[model samples]
Target chain A: MPQEASPHIVRSYEGELRRLREMIARMGGLAERQVADSAQALIRRDTDLAAEVVRRDAELDQMEREVEQFCVRLLALRQPMAADLRLIIAAMKISSDLERIGDYARNGAKRAIVVAQQSLISSLNGFERMSELVQENLRSAIDALVEEDAEKADEVWRSDEPIDGIYNGIFRELLTFMMEDPRNITAATHLLFIAKNMERIGDHATNIAERVHFVVRGEQVTADRPKGDDSASAVAGAPR
Target chain B: MPQEASPHIVRSYEGELRRLREMIARMGGLAERQVADSAQALIRRDTDLAAEVVRRDAELDQMEREVEQFCVRLLALRQPMAADLRLIIAAMKISSDLERIGDYARNGAKRAIVVAQQSLISSLNGFERMSELVQENLRSAIDALVEEDAEKADEVWRSDEPIDGIYNGIFRELLTFMMEDPRNITAATHLLFIAKNMERIGDHATNIAERVHFVVRGEQVTADRPKGDDSASAVAGAPR
Candidate 1:
């Protein structure tokens, strides 16, 4: 009779896996909203919105912890093998990456509050553009992972180059602004950091995409990732 | 006879676990050297040393891959339960943290190569002091993990506040320097980034210590980890 009652108990395992996936998707959505809101707060100089972004980061952090515990429980209770194990592991890694992206967005929001007080810079639009691109990549990466669409993940990976390009432009422009006038240094430095933070968010997106690829393909994505951050070289004026 | 095998065969399982521990220790050593060497290169303006640090990052990257694969194989083959399961998971997480530490060091070294060309600032010594503290913490954290010393890991976690204090000092000092003179902006900006990088390295050390605590104690470390980087509020000039 116990063996015959297996169908009812077996459904719970599938339900647990589905619940884990849904939790990750919820986290991704929160992180993406934080990214978009923080950028808007920066561009609009809305200190209130920026403060809200800072407060929302804790939710993602909490979600990441919950996801980690869930994965561990599944591994211990179900003893997942092969593809199932890989899926659980990838979910854990992806949650961490999403949590980090939320942190970056919070950092940007914090910086935005600072820069808002200063006389606004004309070139601040770059932050908006950069954040928008990274947000798109992050959303796509999560979608790819959830759908198991490695091709879409690959697309997200390829789109990172443009984000780097925007970042490099912002870096050079900020450096030039700082060099031209002493007054620009403080705000320019903050802007540079905000730009750098967005770039890092892009990197995290690529990292998530790679995890998706690994889970689906059972192989590492080995292409040399492109980076366009040549600001140091430009600042040093060193010949490569 | 096969079931009642000699002690030699039984020891192999323990040996595999030891090998994994040794691999992590080796990776930690390499990351420590990278952190120390990169900081020295930055402070001393040693281009050759900075270049060397940059080159050595690839080794840590390779080690992370090896450690990951080894952990995956262990999980699949041994099907470790409870404590052993937690240790393997912790090992995977710790290796990734170490690899990120290696990246931060490499970024610092790369910036150092550029900053070397500019006039040196006396306040830059703060970075040296900060890097030393993080290196010590990282070493202790790895030692804790390898030896399963939860007490030592707690010590490392507690040590992070002082590291943050040093970082905050560096941050405020750099800001004042930049505000005082335009000439200080370029080098000060670079120094600010290096200091931030080291601060992040310290945070990663705390993260490792937390993981070690988890593996040994079977419970998450619940203390409010300290942070002293108040640059954002100072820059924002917001009333607390």
Candidate 2:
């Protein structure tokens, strides 16, 4: 009887691992939607959508807690080794990165509400493009996790430079607006932060991809992460 | 003979736990110094020190990886149960938070270098005070982890409000400067991000405290975290 039950136990453990991946995939889906809606709220100046995005962030926080608790329980009960162990650890870390992505989205939504009240500073086309890239990366990263595809994860990791490139352009353009007219300062400043938030969200997506790569390949991505955001060291001349 | 060997094995495991705590404490000390030196660089307009801070951040990233590797080894070797497991997990989580804190400090340092090249906008007294409080909180949180004092962690958790309050003040003041003259926009904007970095560092400290609290008590902090950053929704009128 004990011998017969052993097979069932092994199968159930495998099922639990599958369930864990599903949970993360679900959480990732919600986070991606939050990012999309927050960006939409900004581009369309929809305060209601922004407000909804803010209110919805609590769900991501709660999902993170659930993921953490589930991972801890698995660690305790299964004492999983090798790949299983790495996958569980990766799940915990990925949940954290996703939670932070949700936070950046929520912050952007709040700033959007403020930006909507001011006159348009310039075309928000850059913001739209930036967010679209971020969401695509976020989606691809999560898909790589669920599919256990390290190549896809590496693609997401390598693709973040373009998002940073867009952010730099937005940063310089906003600074030009501020210098062109003081009236643009308030809106431009808030928009700068929102753009920063999107760039950060992209970074988190890259972090998730790196973790997935580690889980599948049992090694860190050896290449230095490419970064294009030079805004930190940027200096603008005074308005003449 | 087997019993005799078992005693030695248990003692060695105990030593490893002690070593883990020491590792985290040392990492925390380094992170605190980075925060302090970054703020000092900003306040004194010391470009060399700011460059040094930027250079030193790689060490924190390496430390976080070491902590994670150690925890994974322990999990695989000892299969630590209950409190031991919790402590190891908390160390992993706290190291990630500390790594993030180090990144914020490094980014602030980079911006400080740029700010140093520009004319002074306003007194950096607020930046000094904010960094001091953040360092204090960071130190207390690490101490709480080492001493297993949940009350100390709780105290650090409650004290983040003041840091946020300082950040909000700096945000408005920077906006006012940008409106007064476009010449101040570049300096003021960098200073604003530096202040925001300090606030974020403080939040990471609080996150560390919360993790420590959970390790000690085996439950989440149930109270809603107090937040004072209203700058997210702030709006400033055109300059007179």
Candidate 3:
């Protein structure tokens, strides 16, 4: 039988867990900022800020590698059981989600730079609202993970309907712009992709929320997530 | 100190590892078929096949859950060290990648249904070719994981450039189509997204290959994988 761990070992293990949470918190913070900055860059047509968002994506990639290395080390050395093991696994998965979130922001920023070059065709209000909602959900999801609050995570999970609703509106409006004038095609296409990227960012936030819920409750979220994005099968053509 | 494992425990542990590989192989086969079928459905304008692809995505999701639960159980019971531990971690990560690939296929299938309703605007030959390449890469990546062949994984990692190359061509071609006629706008837009979905599925295949490389070599593919997708920064205006 294994002997009881000394107080020193126990304290050190606790510190390591605290450090893991801090790492995730820091990573989540960077990802959230990336999403916000990318949207601001698009709405403001600030290519400089967009370039910054693109440049900062490398940091998130590096952070994910670091988090995975740290988790693997914890698993090997600490041999954590029960909740700690679950938390470590959750950290690895969340880091992957956050990295993907960063990639979407970066891709949006890249397109934002391209969009800045084209004449504006449609109101960007929908993009702004969509971005804000996605950012809020991402922030709440991260907070839920750090705080170990399943209810907060559940709220974020249930709240993605509004983001999808905004995305649907944007999809139709952008298509209309393209149909009205061919000149709008380039700008509208990039904007449509940016809007889609924002919607995907929201989905990643929901994925993070689900992971957090699992960590806190030690069970999967059984309820079917409410989905509102119906633009997938949408069809539109030039007015007859 | 723990006693040396008996023959039966040793044999059972090895059997468990074999079972894990088989599970991954099965899941990977299903994902590859989904990609192929979705592409074929679009090219053939077969809405029935597209709907079937959409319906089958749930199986990949369930498989991902099963893979994770099994990996967690192994981690807890086996406390596997070194290569065994890395393999389990890789399995979890790869399953997530596969699940996302399934989602892309399903999304593409949904868009294909809409595209089928509109008159075909351009040759879907590019789509068929792109889908074939992506399916090949996904298959090779999974085979690398099961066979523990780092070189095969590297080949898949390095081969994604052509998929992105084709996607860039499709992106510009669709924009040109939209600019040519207002009626083509709707179908072209949906085709643009389907092409993008295929590109993303290819990217996920590269991700799986990278994970396999890590599992085999115990280190990441350090040198940057070549990237050819420049559509994010592409800009095109209506021909003056």
Candidate 4:
């Protein structure tokens, strides 16, 4: 077994770590809310809510840095082992996922900023559905982390397929809207970005779920998900 | 200064790490080319090339896993130090970025799958140009890592704004196309996913650039990009 830090120190660190975990979870919760709110704002053309989501992101940024520093310091000072290593790594990965999710929310807000001004798209149907799926995934992924539930992590992994299907559906539908009316182009374009952003948020949630699985099971569950593989030809100067 | 690992081990490990880095670089290179190829496939409607791009992604996924395993073994046995720690972490981040870039390529290909069947959307005029910018950012981000060029990293960071602008322009144009002609929706939808894929690729490139900066500078540059602020929320939990 790897040599761990002082027991008492580790104990205290555990307490601190729990707090850190909670903070990260809280931050994730806030980001999730932001994404939902932003998506809704886009649907309803609510400028105030969109701007609020944008402003709140700065604070999230500050908190993210702080969390990373804490994780690094814990690594340096405590030399956390095994499950601890997994947790720290999970924190890092989940944080990255959360941050990306925040970007999606903010992007949704920005699109809301632009699209809200003009005529709203009549069918925000798939967009709404996609947003809800992402939110559910985000919630479950974090809950899996909190509970250390490998089962829950697996559930999140399986859920990604349908999310993609929805995104694909939205992609086609939005195209129909954009293709039909030049006047509808501006609003439709913003809506498309919003849909893609929501899809990505679901993807990130899936990523976090992967991390959560790794943390709990000590095996990579992400292998079951879609991963990029066009890299083998890279070594021998093979034609890309 | 941090203590070094066993010299003989370090030397061999260094060689392995170098090889690993190169492999990842090559992977990055491949993923970059695939992005370019898929974009070209979309423009040219080469369905066969798009299919080939999809088939090749499996190899990239395998390489990514290989790099991760190699890094873990080195860390476990070699117990790397500061620059080395940074290097390993950087490799991890780079590999992840490379893998995601590959995903974008597949994404592009998938869109091409649809676009290949339909008549080309006339308004997707600047797509190739926008894709080149995204591809350039991917190339430079990898170069920044290879050369340890902080300035190049910064350059990559700055370059993303224009890609965003192009993406915005594309979104609007596509919307306009759909609005003008209902017949254009099918091709237009495929083109939009392609655009979204390209934009996602650009974001992943920016992620690599950010990771390179972190490796070289040891400072988190997460706050600098003001686009959507996605990374801060999911992982920002405070240590309780």
- TM-score for each model: 0.95, 0.97, 0.97, 0.84
- For A128-218, candidate 3 gives per-residue lDDT tens digits of 9999999999999999988999999999999999999999889988898999999999999999999999999999999999999999999
* Model 4 C-alpha lDDT per residue in residues B35-102, reported as the tens digit of each score: 98888888887889998998999888888888777766666566566677777766876787788888
**Chain B TM for prediction 1:** 0.94
DockQ of 4: 0.20
Tell me the tens digit of each residue's lDDT in model 2 across B20-45: 99999999999999999999999898
- What lDDT tens digits, residue by residue, belong to model 3 across residues B1-240? 998769998899889988998999999999999999999999999999999999999999999999998998888888888899999999999999999999999999999999999998999989999999999999999999999999999999999999999999999999999999989988998899999999999999999999999999988889998999999977674331
Tell me how each candidate scores on DockQ against the true complex: 0.51, 0.82, 0.82, 0.20
Displacement of residue B41 (Cα, Å) in model 3 is: 0.6
Reference contacts preserved by each model: 0.40, 0.69, 0.73, 0.26
Cα deviation of A109, candidate 3, in Å: 0.2
The best-first sequence of candidates by lDDT reads 3, 2, 1, 4
What is the CAPRI rating of model 2's predicted complex? high
Cα distance off (Å), candidate 3, residue B203:
0.8
Error of 1 at B121 (Å): 2.6
**Looking at candidate 3, what is the lDDT of residue B18?**
88
Which stretches of candidate 3 lie above 4 Å from their native place? Answer: A1-4, A237-240, B1-4, B237-240
Badly placed stretches (over 4 Å) of model 2 are A1-5, A238-240, B1-5, B237-240
What global local distance difference test value does model 4 have?
0.74
